[model samples]
Each structure stands twice: as C-alpha cells, then as structure tokens.
Target: MQAGAGQTPARRSRRRSPVPFLIAWIVIIMMGTAGAWLYSEHMKQQITAQIEAQTARQIAAMENNYEQRIKELDAGYSSQIAKLQSEVDSLNELLTFTKDNASNKTDNSNKLYTQLSQVQKQLDELKRKLDMLK
Candidate 1:
C-alpha cells in the first residue's frame, strides 16, 4: 500500500451537454438578423423621404419657370399690339387727308387704295395671329 491511497473518489469530472451552448448561439444569430433588418428599413425610409423632397423641389422650380416665361410673352405681345394699333391709326389719318384734298388723279388714288387694302388684309392676319396666341 502506498501511503494511504483513497478508498473512493468523492466526485468525478463530468462532460457538459452542448445543447445549452448551441441554443445560446442560435439566439445571438437571430438577434443580429433582426437588428440588420431594422437598420435596412430605417435606411430605406430615409432614402424615400429624400427622393420625395427632391421631386417636390423640381416641380416647384418648373412651375416658376413656366410662369416667368408666360409673363415675358404677355409683355412682348402687348407692346406689339400697341405698335400695330398706332400704325393703323396713322394710316387712317393719311387716307383721310388725301381724300379731303381730292387731287382727282385716278392713278395715284388707285395706288393708294390698293395699298390701304393690303394693309387691311395684313391687319386682319395679325388679328388672327393674336387671337391664336390668346
């Protein structure tokens, strides 16, 4: 006998089951997946908001540009109309003066009448164009 060997061991080393460790790992992975999904959703929402804001700004800019263009066109048309009316009035005064003088020259009267008719036709055409613009 070697110096009082133990008759029996009080306890033995035991192997632990792997099931708890496996369960813990699975839980951690699931939590990570959920977090990733939430982050992706948040990013998507932010992107959508930015896009909508940009679109709204573009639309507002376009509307403003069109309004400015329309205003410019209106001013131009007004000046043109006033100029045409003045020309017509001046022509009328000239015709009246010529008639009152009555030189009795048939050729000159005929030429003046033809020019007046042509001017009238041009005025009519301009009126039609103005109406179309309106």
Candidate 2:
C-alpha cells in the first residue's frame, strides 16, 4: 500500500455498537410475547363462549323433555280420574234402583197381611154360630 500525498494513514472503519442491536432484539422479543398473549386470550374467550352456548342448548332440551313428561302425566291422571268418576256414578244409580224396588215390595206385603187377618176372623164367627144351633 502507498500513502497518499496529502492524507495520513487510512483510518479503520468504525464498528457498529452492540447496544442498538441489543435494544432491537429486546423490542422484537417484547412484541412477539405480546402478540402471543393476545392470541391466547382470544382463543380462551372463544372456547368459553362455545361452552356456554352448548350448556344453554342442553338446558333447553332438558326443560322441553320435562315439560313433555309433565303433560303426559297430567293426561294419564285425568283419564284415570274420569274412569273412577264414571264408576262411582254407575254404582250410585244401582243403589238408588235397588232401594226403590225394595220399598214397593214392602208395601205390597203389608196389604196382603191385612187381608189374611180379616178372612180368619170371619171364619171363626161362623163356626161359633153353628155350634150354638147344634
């Protein structure tokens, strides 16, 4: 190498400081961490909402089944009660009919007994008069 006429020895190029590189690396790490955290939070929110929606659907289905069962039970009970009521009404009618028939029979028997007593008295009086004549 030859030295120039007006210039001294060539100066070495200045090296870049490591401080700016370190700062840039730190900023990149921070941004990556923040982005990851945001993504994780968003995923958590989505999962929570999905679970809540599924729970709501299950609850609604259970309620519908319960209501249907209740309606079926009510219908069965109503039918059974109606049958019992009909049976009770029929028994009452039978009891009334039997009572009226017994009353009629009792009245007829009393009249027959009174007629037999009158006939017996008349026969006894005839027998006494025939004995006195003899």
Candidate 3:
C-alpha cells in the first residue's frame, strides 16, 4: 500500500498537459483555412481572365463579319450604279438623235423624251442612295 502511493505521485509528475496539444491543433487548423482562402481567390482570378478573353474573341469575330458584309454590299452598289450610269448615257444619246432627225415623228419623239427623263431620274436617285451609304 505504501509503495503504490509512491508510484502514483511519480506518474502524475511525468504526465503531459493537454494545453500544448490543443494550441498546436488550433495553429494547424488556422493554417489550413488561410491556405484554402488563398487558393479560392487565385481560382477566381483565373476564371475571370478566361471569361474576359472569350468575350474579346467574340467581339472581334462580330466586327470582322460586319466589315465583310459591308464590303460585299458596297461592291454590289458600285456595280449597280455603273450599269445605271451607262444606261442613262445611252438613252441620252438616243433621245438627242431622235430630236434632231424626227421632224414628222412627234409621237415617237415625245415617247423618247419621257423615257429619257425617267431614266435620268432613276440614275439620280441611285447616285443619292450611293452617297448616303458612303
């Protein structure tokens, strides 16, 4: 009985405190939380960068498509204007010739003059449209 009492006192003096282990665990948990927060922020930045890059690419493609369509329409308008101009010129020449030579053909000369006026009006309208487009 006296020997057991002495062994109990020695064991109590050699025992470790739970306070140091609790502090170590707390430090470890804090470090893990901080690391997770930093990783989350880094991932968010990367995702933002990727989204912005995709948007820029989409914008560029749209701009290119619009530019090409504009060029094609411009070419179509140019050809139409050239053809109309040539028609007006030819009609003018024919109308002048008819006026000078057709002394007894009043009906034919009047028809030719009306047609020339109509063609000239159309040419002027087309020119106005082309200028507005520019």
Q: Return the top candidate by lDDT.
A: 3
Estimate every model's Cα lDDT from 0 to 1.
Answer: 0.78, 0.68, 0.84
Alpha carbon RMSD to native, model 3: 4.0
> Tens digits of per-residue lDDT for model 1 on 5-113?
5544555457999999999999999999999999999999999999999999999999999878767776776676677667767777777777778878666667767
The C-alpha stretches of model 1 lying farther than 4 A from their native spots are: 1-14, 92-134
lDDT of 2: 0.68
Alpha-carbon deviation at 88 in model 2, angstroms: 2.7
Clashes of each: 0, 0, 0
Better of 1 and 2 by TM-score: 1
Stretches > 4 Å off in candidate 3:
1-33, 103-106
Candidate 3 structure lDDT: 0.84
**Which pairs of residues collide in candidate 3?**
none
70-107: candidate 2 lDDT, tens digit per residue: 67766665565555555545555554565567766755
Residue 114 local lDDT, model 1? 75
Model 1 RMSD in angstroms: 5.4
The C-alpha TM-scores of every prediction are 0.61, 0.56, 0.64
Candidate 3 positional error at 78, Å: 0.6
RMSD of each: 5.4, 26.5, 4.0
Give me the overall lDDT of model 1: 0.78
Give residue 14's error in model 2 in angstroms. Answer: 6.1
